[model samples]
Target: MGEPVARIMVVDDNEMNIRVLEALLSGRGYTVSTAHDGEEALEKIQEEIPDLMLLDAMMPRVDGFAVLKKLKENPKTRLIPVVMLTALSDLDSNVKAVELGADDFLTKPFNKALLLARVRSLLHVKFLLDELESVDEIIAMTARIVEAKDEYTEGHVERVTAFALGLGQAAGLNEWSMRNLRRGALLHDLGKIAVPDDVLNKPGKLDKEEWDHILRHPEVGASILKGLKSLASVVDIVLHHHEKLDGSGYPDGLKGDEITIESRIMAIADIYDALTTKRSYKEGMSKETALRILQEEGQEGKLDERLVNIFSQLVERGEFESLGDRIPNLFNIPPPPPR
Candidate 1:
C-alpha cells in the first residue's frame, strides 16, 4: 500500500490566503483542512488532530502565537508540526513564533516550492515521532501488564515516576535529564518480566535463590535497554537505581559519586515508593516512618544525602503535582533519540 496521505491544517483569517494554500497543498496530493482563526482550528484539532498545521502568524482573536502556545503546552497536540505563515517577517515575530514552539517560519507570498518542502520535511519528522510514540506505548504497556500480574503493586510505575520527577525537579535537573528520569522510573522494573510469575507474585519473603533472582533485575533491565542508543542515560538509571552509596547495593556494586545523580534520585524514589506501598508480604509504612527511614539511610550513606534531603522537603511542602493520575502525560516530554 502507498504511504498514508498527510493531513495539514491551514489556520488563516484571510479567505484568499487559505484558498491559495489549500489549492497548492491539495494539488500535491495532500489532505487539507482550513480554519478561519485559531479558536476554530483548536476546536477542530480536539476532534481530529492533523499531522501538520500551517498557521498564519496574525489573526483576529486567538492568533497564531496564542494558538502555538496552547498547543505546545498540551502533550496531546504538542508534537504536531506548526509552520508560521504570515506577512509579519520581522525578526521578533519569527523569534517569538519559534520560541512558542513553531516548527518552521515562512512569510506570506511564500514560494510554493519552499512551502511544500518545509511541509514535507515536517511531515516526515511527524511520522518518525509517531513511530517513537508507539515504541514508548509498548514499553509502558508492558510495564503496566507486569504490574497488573501483582495485584498489590498497582500504580507502582506511575507513582515512582511521579516521585522521581518531583525529586528530579527539586534536584535542579535540566529538561533533558528530567525526560530520561521519567522514562527510567517508569520502565525501571521491566527486567522483572523475565522472572517466573510464581516468583514475582510470591507472597512470602523470598528464599536466597529467589532473592538472588530479584537482585539481578537491575542488570537484566539495563541489558534490555542498553542497545537502544537513545536510552543510554536511561540505561544507567535502570542498571544502577538499586545501587547504594555504601557499595552494598546490587549487580555491579557501584558506590559514591560513581552512581550518577540521575540514578541516585531514582534510588531514593524507588526506595520511598517501595517503603510506603503495601505489598502482600508486608503492610505499608506510614509517611513519617518512611521519611525517617530515608533520612536514616541518607545519613548512613545508603542513599545520596543531598537528594534525600531535597525529596523530604518536597514531600513535606507538597510542592509537586500528582502525575500518577495523568498516566498519559506521565512521560509528557516525548523525547526524540537524544544526541
Candidate 2:
C-alpha cells in the first residue's frame, strides 16, 4: 500500500503564497487546509490538528514565531510537526524558528519536492513518537497494578517514580531512559510478594538468615516478572535495585555501571523512601535525616552521586512531603527541613 496522505495546513497572509502551497501540496495527494493569517491559522488548528503545518513567518497580530511558540507550549498541539515558511532566509530567522521548535524551514522560493520530502520525514517521526508513547502508557498501567497490590506501598510507586524521574531528568537522561526509570521505580519491590508475611512485616530487626532471605527478593521478583512480555525491561530494574555500586549488595553482587541508570535512580528513590517511611519494625526516619544518610552512604559509591544529589534537592524543595501521607499519617513524623 502507498504511504498515507498527510494532512497539511498552509498558513500565509498573502493569497498567492497560500494558493501556491495548497495547489502544490494537493497535487501530491496531501489533504490540504489554507489559513489567511496567523489568527485564522490558530483557529483552524483548534478545529483540527494537521499532520504538518507549513507556516508563514510574517503575519499580522501573531507572527510565525509567536504561533510556533504557542503550538509548542500546548501539550495537545506540541507534537504536530511545523515547518516555517518565510521570505526572511537570514540565519537569525532560521535559528529563531528552530529554537522555537519548528521542525523544518522553507524559504520563500521553496522547492516543491523538498517541501514534500520534509513533510513526509517529520510526519514519520511523529508517528514513531506516538507509537512509543502508547507503549509507555501500557507499561505504566501494568506497573500501577503491581503497585496497587500492597497498600502500604501503594503510593510508594508514584512517589518513588517521581523521585526517580526528577533524578533522571536532572542527570540529563533521555526521554526513553526517564520512562524506563519510572517503570523500574514502580516495579522494583515486586519481589517482596515472594517473602512470607511474617518476614516482610516483622516488627523486630531481622537476623542474619532472615536478612539473607530478604535480600533475595530482587532476584525472586525479577524472575517472576521477567516471564511476562510487557514487563521485560522492568525485570532488570527489579533484580538490580538492591545491587550496590561497590559490589556489596544483593543476589548477584553486580556493581557500578553494570547497573543501568534506571536501576541506579530506582535505588536512590527506593532506599530514601525506605528510610523516611515507617515499616512494621521501626518509625520512619525524618526527611532531614534521610537526606543526610543518602549523601553520606551514597558517597561510598553504592548509589549514583547525581541521583542522590537530585533527591536531596527535591527533598529540600518539598517534593516528598505528601509522600509520608500516602502510607498513612500513622506516624507523627517530625517537621521536615525549612522549604
Which lDDT values do the candidates have, in the order given?
A: 0.86, 0.78
lDDT of 2: 0.78
Model 1 Cα RMSD, 1 decimal = 3.5
lDDT of 1 by residue, 1-339 (tens): 655899999999999999999999999999999999999999999999999999999999899999999999897888899999869668899999989989999997899999999999899988977777776777677678767766667888888888898888878998888878878888888888777778888887889998888788888989988898767878888988889999999878898989998899999989988999888778999877998999999999999889989998998886544554576676444654433
What is the per-residue lDDT of model 2 for residues 1-339, given as tens digits with 9 covering 90 to 100?
Answer: 555677989888999988888888888788999988788889999999998899999898889999999999987788888999889779899999999999889897988889878888898887766665665565556656655555455567666776777777878887666555666776677777667666666777889888877788888888887777755777888898877889997878888789888888788888887787776667899888988889887888777777788778877997656765553431111211111
Q: Which pairs of residues collide in candidate 2?
A: none
> What lDDT is reached at residue 39 by model 1?
97
Residue 238 displacement (Å), model 2: 4.3
lDDT of 2 at 324: 52
